[model samples]
Target: YKAESGEIFAVNPICTHMKCDVKWNTSEKSWDCPCHGGRFDCKGKVLTGPPAQDLEVVNLEQLIEKDNS
Candidate 1:
């Protein structure tokens, strides 16, 4: 998030187009595509792409709990 103050906004770790890894793009301030030409902003809105849809977000705490057992 473009924090007015210090902040943390969480999102999914997977790409919407493919199962590629996403990294924090410091210069552009967004998640970048490594496999396809997909681009998603901090809040997970599709900025550019073959995948013209936002990445799916999952609740981290719930997902971790589900995976554990």
Candidate 2:
């Protein structure tokens, strides 16, 4: 995610609510969930939601390794 200061960050694509996948909103610069109107900031903090928690951070390298296996 891109902050107002232009800092970039990354977080999991999954929503904390209902385990729904989140989509990036480039214009708004946040992750949004269609399932329950959950919203997360670039830092993965909950902006608004049926979700009550921040988005989880995932290890990309581990995920890549797992995918290849």
Name the candidate that leads on TM-score. 2
Please give each candidate's TM-score. Answer: 0.70, 0.72
lDDT of 2: 0.85
- Give the Å error, residue 22, model 2: 0.2
List ranges where model 2 is wrong by over 4 Å.
2-7, 59-69
* TM-score of model number 1: 0.70
lDDT string, candidate 1, 1-69, tens digits: 445566556678588777787777888988888888688887778888877668776566787799999
lDDT (Cα atoms) of all candidates against the true structure: 0.77, 0.85
lDDT of 1 at 32: 87
**In candidate 1, what residue range of length 10 has the lowest lDDT sum?**
1-10
lDDT per residue as tens, model 2, 1-69: 657787557787888879989999888888999998998987788999689999997666787899999
Model 2 residue 6 CA deviation (Å) reads 7.2
- Badly placed stretches (over 4 Å) of model 1 are 1-4, 58-69
- Distance (Å) between predicted and true CA of 38, model 2? 0.5
> Model 2: clashing residue pairs?
1-9
